[model samples]
Target: MATIKITTESVAALTKSAVPNKTTFYFDNELAGFGLYRTTTGTGTYFAEFRPVAGGSKKRLKLGRVGTLKANEAREAARRAIANAALGKDLAQNRSDERASLTVEELVSKYIEEYVAEHKKASTAGLYRMLLKKHVKPRLGSIKATSLTRVDVQRAHALMTREARVSANRAIKLLSAAYGWGSRHGHVQEGMNPASGIKLNEEEGRERFLTTAEMLAIGNAMIEAETIGLPVDAGTTKHAPKGQLVVMSPYATAAIRLLMLTGARLREILNLRWSEVDLERGVLRLPDSKTGKKTVFLPTAAVDIIKGLTKLGSYMIAGESAGTKHEKPRSDLKRPWAAICKRAGVNGVRIHDLRHTFASTGVGDQMGLPVIGTLLGHADPSTTQRYAHLADEAARRAVEAIGGKIAAAMNGGK
Candidate 1:
């Protein structure tokens, strides 16, 4: 060990200093616990050395490499580190603890690996991963989980809300789930969820039903996009990689049509298997659904559409490519649906709204609430209550008919 007063001058000279056979250390005369070391391979780093006040083994905490950290900054860091050591803190252990505290990015990654990969379906997990990469990770990933505050969460959610309210709500919901999972599983501190109590933006559930004209426009646009390419905004101020040509996908077309014809969840449609569809019975027996195993009766129109399609091994709407992860059924509906809507001038409607319209049209026809529930595969009665107004109108008509007959009887009696 060489004793030297560590100054800018001293550190500058030490940059060229390295031992041929072994590692060497230079002790700082002014700072007791501070020093610089150089390896035989010419790797130089600054470190702070201290023994615990409670009488333990000597601990060394690495500050940074030469040229990366200035001598003064390293010395100041070392000073603080040594003071903490004298106060019964283990600098090395503290460092280890800090590293162990997961950042938001790390938390989501771990969540995807541990919980999602094991528990969720591939399609479901893929959506979570997509949100993490595109939304959560980019915005709040670098922030440590323990360091996250309510304000930080609110700000992040607010920013996303400005971009897209529905997307913002979904992202926040997923974020909350992730935070809860992390906390429960010890990825974050117990009983600490910064996302807790952060009020989510009110997302009005859409019940937009496409009118006859709108439907015709949409159908025509789908044809146009499938035949030629649909012109899309491509999400750019400049040029986009995929260009303005959003070539429509046949699978997406089928998916959208099926959604319109049969009121089913998007995932149910995307993950529909050949085994599930009972052509003879004119129904689908989905063993897995948003609620549970459900029997979605196929209308003659929906069944005809299904019959018109070519068989694509195991799935009604199989993905393109013979062998790949995405080679199953369709997994997404963003681009094709966007093209259809944009070209057709049918804006402010989501794929889920197609399901809503199915129920809406059913209600208009005075379909029983229980029957509609069965059709939509709603596990809860409350789920069907959103369309209760249809039942109300039917009840009103029945009452009027009964009252009119009673009035006629009274007039005849008089």
Candidate 2:
């Protein structure tokens, strides 16, 4: 029988000379469940040996090795096990139960119903649902939430990144949040969030802005497409094939121009109705937006586009007037926008990028971010901080001017 002192000093001082054979156990004096177990092969490890407070067979679990764990570290691990045993908790069994029941789809559904629907904004909840349905559900939804690993999260992100990088990150973000939600609600064991430490795909923030030349080209393309019609492709000019011919309605052209002039999102402009346009106030008072009730300060250029629309029905861009097919306002300008992009040689550009260009133009003109944020109707100043790059140039210009003045003053009229 091995003597049982089990202190750092005592365990370190124990000699191999007293070894009998087989294995030996040395229980701790201060910490009840902590002990040292060694085999005849000279292998030794720290362990926690305890019977349940609910009355069952005692279980022994290895904590760590003597040399690698240090006596203090091993004791701390043993203390945690002893604490769990006293509480009648079996960590291993709980993990098994979680693995059997908790799945990615189940956890996401629970998160949306219990947390998102009640707490998050309606628009946010909708976006989360869409992201899960399109990106997450089809990929990792069937996997056990507890069995989820960092590799699995990374793989799912990789699959979507080839199509759209931002979309991939959003899906990853939702999964991460859902896992945390699961942990809090006891749907899964705590600290079992695989999405927590997973490496998300590196997303290059798209800051594409139309140059003056490019803008001129787009302007000419819009005119040609609306009036004379243009080829759907680059090389197919005057003698284009039958399917290669495309044209943008004057109304659709105006909508695309408004996107370039105002920093409002796609839905904000597409779903815009005649009632929302306040020609007298010169502001588009959107009753609801992603950021809640917001107002977009329409520049003269944007105002011209809205005023030019015929107001065929309830919408500014309504086609077919009072027809039932076009009653709910123009839902999309996808085809027109694509034709415009192709004609202008601005291929690979998304309609959303036009919003970025709007902000970029404001920044280049030496506008403050707060003022731009107000123009964009950002609810938070920090939300407008992404445009801080434009502010940096203005700051540099101001500093240079001030430094020049100070140098001239200090030169003593030299």
Candidate 3:
């Protein structure tokens, strides 16, 4: 080691020199209190070290090769390191400590790998991945988990609300779950969940159902559209829009028809295996339902629809591809249903509303509350009480029938 009267330019020249291994130079400069000397150790590589104090134990740290670390900046850094050492402090330890602090990206990765992947179902896990990828990760992945604030969560929620309220709610729910998992495992400190209180006001009350006139109009339109499409070649189109298929099984049509006619839940109709239908008995056996499995007797018209559908395929509801078992039956009701509704001029009514239509029409027809409940597969009779006007109308009809008899007897006695 040699103590050279050092300047920034002198250190730069020394760092630029070519030599057979690492080199060191002690320099004194106004900008760089300590300067380094380094040279090429092998092809294209060089190393250098610097210390501020001339006679102090060498704090030899590697500086990069000829072109990488610019001479001026390296000299300036060398000066700062020397200055720190003169004050008996280690700059390297401070860098290491800063690097060790937890970042949001690191915590999210650990939470997914350790908690979500291990415990959640494949479908549910996929949903979580989607929520995090679309909503959470972009906003907060780079933030430190321990330092996550309610404001960060609120900002994410506000952005999501512009896209969709339901989706915003789902994103918030998923984020809460992730944070809860972190808290349970001691990754996050105790506090109220930022996502906990946010609520999305969705469209509530009973779903809208199409009326009988609407159903007739829909059916006639589907027939006319098919007649119109007869001239077109099948291969001409790449893909039909949802619910727009031209040809359909009588069974599928009836299944959809019954869905509108009787207002049965889509899953109730779709999940109907051949084993569940008793054509001769006129009773459908639901092994389980949303309200728990109970036997529901089909009305004569509904039974007629079931009989027509029994001929379509092994499954009660058939898909586009015939003679193949659908991984899950009754998956989609695209094209044909859309064509039907389009012809009817009713827009934005979902297939599920067929059941709603059934309930609504029954209520309109003055069916008793208990009868409507049974027809709609409600386990609790009280659930059917919302349509109490139907029962009131039935009671009025009964009184009218008795009143006519009483009037006849009174007239006869007079």
Best by lDDT: 1
> Which regions in candidate 3 have their CA more than 4 angstroms from the true location?
1-148, 174-192, 222-245, 248-252, 310-314, 380-382, 389-414
TM-score of 3: 0.56
Q: Which digits, one per residue and each the tens of the lDDT, describe model 1 over residues 1-414?
A: 999998889888877655546788989999998998888888778889999899968988787777767889889989989999899877677655754777988887887878888988765788788888877887899998778888998999888887778777777777888877775444565456788788888766667778878889989988887777665573211234455665565767888888998998888888888778888899989987877688888889888878877776677786765245556666678877876887788989999889888888887777789989888988898989998987798778877878988988989944
- Candidate 3 clashing pairs? 104-143, 242-335, 243-334, 243-335, 243-336, 244-335, 244-336, 245-335, 245-336, 263-355
lDDT of 3 by residue, 1-414 (tens): 556655445555665555645544454434434444443453222223444343565555433333444556555566666567667665544533433475655665666678778875544566677777777778777777766777888887888778777767787777677666555433554333566666554744655767667878877764554455411122212355543434544555667766766667776777677888887888788887667777767778888767655344556777554456544566656655665665567888888877776776777667667778888888888887766765677678778878988998999944
The residue-by-residue lDDT of candidate 2 on 259-320, one tens digit each, is: 88888887788777788999788888889887889998888878877877775777776664
> Which one wins by lDDT: 1 or 3?
1
What is residue 395's positional error in candidate 1, in angstroms?
2.8
Clashes of each: 0, 0, 10
RMSD of each: 17.0, 11.5, 20.4
lDDT of each: 0.80, 0.78, 0.63
Candidate ranking under TM-score, highest first, comes to 1, 2, 3
lDDT of candidate 2 vs native?
0.78
